[model samples]
Target chain A: MNRQNSNKNNDHRDDFPGSFRSNPFHVPDHYFDELPGRIKSRIEQDKSRKRLFYLRPVVQKALLAAAGLALLIGLAIALLHERNDVHVYIGQFNGISAPDIEATLLPSDLDEYTLVSFILETQDFTGMPSGTDITDEEIKSYLLETNNIEPLILHY
Target chain B: MHHSDEEIIPLIQDESTREKGFDRLVKAYQQEVYWLIRRMVIDHDDADDLTQDTFVKVWNNLDRFRGESALFTWIYRIATNEALAHLRKKRISFSFLALEKTSTAAIPEYNDAFYRSDNAMRQFQKALAELPDKQRLIFNMKYYDDLTYEQISEITGTSVGGLKATYHQAVKKIKKKLSLE
Candidate 1:
C-alpha cells in the first residue's frame, strides 16, 4: 500500500511537463549580506519605541497630578488671604465706638430720617442738642461741612 | 563555520551572546527562508520584506521556543505564515480585480534573459500563480523546495493525507492549465 501510494505521488509529478524547480526570482546583489544589519536596526528601534510606549502614560499622569495639586494649593492660598483681610477689618472695628463705627460704615448719602433713627438707636441723648435748639443755619452748615447736602436736597 | 541549532539556540537564549547567535542564525538560514517566501509571494520586494519580518519575529519569540520541533521547521513556519498572510491581505484589498489579473500582477517582468526565451517556464509560473494561495504554497514546497509531505506537514500544521490530496489537486490543475495554454 505504501509503495502504491508512493508511485501514485510520482505519477502526479510525471503529469507535469518540465521541471518547475528553477527559480525565476533574483535579488539585488549583497541583499543577504546587509539584511542582518537592517533587521538588527529594526529590532533596536522597536525596543526603544516599546520603552517609550510603556513610559509615556506614566509621565503624563504624574504631570497631570502635579498640575492639579498646584491648582488646589493656589485656590486655598487665595481663599485664606481673603479670609485674613476680613479678620483684620473686624479686629480694627473692635477698638472704635459705635458712633464712629456707624459713621465709617454708613453711606454719607443717608437721609436725615434714617440717620436720626440710626443715631437714636445707638447714641446717648443726654449731652446732645435737640432739633428745636439748633437753628436751620447750623443744620445747613453741618450738612455742607459733612458733604451730605446734595443727597439731602435730592431726597427732599 | 556553519553552526547547528544546538550551538545557535544556546547562544541566542543567553542575553550576553544573543546578538551574535542571531546574526549567525540569519546568515545560515536567510537563503532558505528567502526562497521559501519568494516562491510564495512571487515578487522579490515582498519576499525580501517578509523574509526580514520573519527573522524579526523569530528574534522576538526566541525565548519561547521549546525545542519541540526543529529550529529550521519553526523558521520555515514563520516564513510560510508571513507569505500566506501577505497573499491574504493582497487578495482582500484587491478583491475587486479578477484572480487572474491579481496573480499576473505579481509576476516579475520578463525582461530577464532567462525568462524571455523560456515560454514553458512562463506558462508554468503563470499556472502556479493561478492556484489558491495555500494550494500554491503546497505545490511550491513539494515541487520546488523538495520538502517531503511529513516536513511540509510539520511546517504547515496540515495532516499528511490532506497535504497529499492538496498537492495532487495542485498538480492536476497545473497540468490542465499548461495543456490548455
Candidate 2:
C-alpha cells in the first residue's frame, strides 16, 4: 500500500495551469502581461494626494499617542534601571552581599527551564516593585557611580 | 524585457523622464506580481486592485529606492508583501503557521477561472496554498521563479538555510497532499 501510494504521488506532476506551470514560472512577467490600462487613470487621480505629504489630525494624534507611550516607558525604564543600579552600588559600597541582593532585590537565576517560574513569580512583582525598601535610588546611584572601588566609601 | 533597473534608476533620478521610466518598470513586473497576487486572493477583481496599488507605490517611490539589492528582489519583496497584506485584510481561509507558511500551495488548488481541476498541478497548487507564507514564498520562488537560494533570501528576507528547509518541506507536503487526493 505504501509503495502504491508513493507511485501515485509520483504520477501527479504532469499537470499545471495558465501556461505558467507548463512554461517557465515568470511571475512578474506574467502579472505585467495582463495589467489593465485603468491603472494609469488611478495613478493620475492619486498623484496630487501623494504630493500633499500631510498627515491628517487623526494620524497625528495616533502618532502622538504612540510617541507619548514610548517616552513614558523609556522614562520609567531609565528610572527603574537607575534605582536598581543605585541599590547595587549601595550594596557594593556597604559591603552588602551580591548573593543577598540576588536573593532579594536582584535576580540571578538565568535558565531557560526557569522561564515559567520567573513569569509566575513576576505576578508578585506588581505590589512590591523594589525588593529592597530603600527610597531615592537616584542619589545613591549618583554617589556610587564612580569606577574606582574605594575601601568602604558607602555614605549610609 | 525593457531597460534594466540600473538603466531606469538613472532616468528616474532625473525629473524629465521619470514617468517614462516608471512605465517601463510597470511593464516589467506587472504580470509576475499579478499572478502571484491572483493565486493568493483567488479573486480576479481583488488581484487587479492590488496589482495596480503595487505599481503605483513603486512609481511614486522609485526615487527613494536605494540600490543596495537587486531591483528584482526589491520589487518581488514589495509585491509579496502587498499581496500578503491584502490577503490578511481579506483574511486567509487556510493557515499553516507552526509548520511552513502555506500548507496549501504545493498543488494546483485554483478554480475554473484560474486553473482546471483533475490535473496533477491542482493538487500541488492546493498544497502550496495550504502552506504558510514562508513555505509558499519559497516554493513560489524556487519552483516557479527558479531563483537561487541566495537570491530568494534577499527577496524574502529569509536565511538560505530556512529557504532550503522550507522548499524541502514544501515539496514533501505537496507529495503528501497529492497522495491524499
What value does the lDDT take at residue B76 in candidate 1? 89
Candidate 1: tens digits of C-alpha lDDT, residues B1-181: 5677878888888889988989989888888899889877766778888988999999999888877888888998999999999988887232212534565445343333134437788677777777888998888888866677888899999999999999989888988978998
The model with the greatest DockQ is 1
**Number of the top-ranking candidate, with TM-score as the measure:** 1
Instruction: Give the best candidate by lDDT.
Output: 1
> Candidate 2 regions off by >4 Å?
A1-20, A23-36, A50-156, B94-110, B113-117
Q: Please give the range of 10 consecutive residues that has the lowest summed lDDT in model 2 chain A.
A: A1-10
TM-score of 2: 0.55
Q: Write out the backbone clash pairs for model 1.
A: none
Q: Model 2, range A1-156, lDDT digits (tens) per residue?
A: 000112232222343344435531224344444564666777887876755546566688999999999999999999999989955754452355544534543343334333323334433433655666655454345434634322222111
Q: Estimate each model's TM-score.
A: 0.67, 0.55
Query: What lDDT tens digits, residue by residue, belong to model 2 across residues B56-90?
Result: 77777778887777777777788888888887776
